[model samples]
Target: MENVVPFKIQIISILATLGFMYFIVRQIIRGKLREEYSIVWFACTIVLLIFSFWRKGLEQISLALGVFYPPSLLFLLAIGAIVTFLVHLSIVNSKLQSQIKDLAHEVAFLKEKQLNESTIK
Candidate 1:
């Protein structure tokens, strides 16, 4: 015989999921969660919904998209992208620091030159 669960349990699970989604949305609206950060949560919700419902169509789409493990793969990709972006930002920061130092030296030299010229006059 196939295993069976009560309808009420399934309904409770669904309501719980909806409540969780509502909480996340409220946090997002209140600015506790940023838009970019929320992408991960939204993606997680989609993946969770698909797995919880055992949706064949979603599984097929995941397979077609070459995501062997949907949740893990998506998380890995997001982290990888964030790491790459941070690396890029570090490089930009170094360049800006060098420029700032150059500007500071130039300002100091100009001030010294002006002071010397005024003293001579």
Candidate 2:
């Protein structure tokens, strides 16, 4: 037997997905979220909306991917997305650290040169 989600649940899920999409858009409009970062959120929400509308499609995808349990597949995808996003953030953090270090060194050098010139004058 194919796993089936109740009609009420599907409606709720679709509403939640739309609510999430609205939140993302609002954030972008408010300048709290950048469009580049919002792409992933929008993509994920769209997938959720599609799945919510096509109830049995997830099962078909799960079976095609050799995942015996559809919910497990969903969990796997969510975890994967989280991990990927985290790694991206980590990379950005590293770059920012390097840039901060370089800026600090340049500031120190400029301060030392200014002090030397003032002492000579």
Report lDDT (CA) for all predictions.
0.69, 0.93
Tens digit per residue, CA lDDT, model 1, 5-70: 245654665667677788889999999987775676676566555545653444465578887765
TM-score of each: 0.48, 0.86
The positional error of residue 63 in candidate 1, measured at the CA in angstroms, is 3.0
- Model 2: how far residue 46 lies from native, Å: 1.1
Residue 42 lDDT, candidate 2, scale 0-100: 92
In model 2, the runs with Cα more than 4 Å from the true position are: 1-3
Q: What is the lDDT, from 0 to 100, of the residue 41 in candidate 1?
A: 63
Model 1, position 85: C-alpha lDDT score: 66
Best-fitting candidate, measured by TM-score? 2
| Per-residue error (Å), model 1, residue 81 | 0.9
Q: Which 10 residues in a row give candidate 2 its minimum summed lDDT?
A: 1-10
Which residue pairs overlap in candidate 1's backbone? none
How many residue pairs collide in each prediction?
0, 0
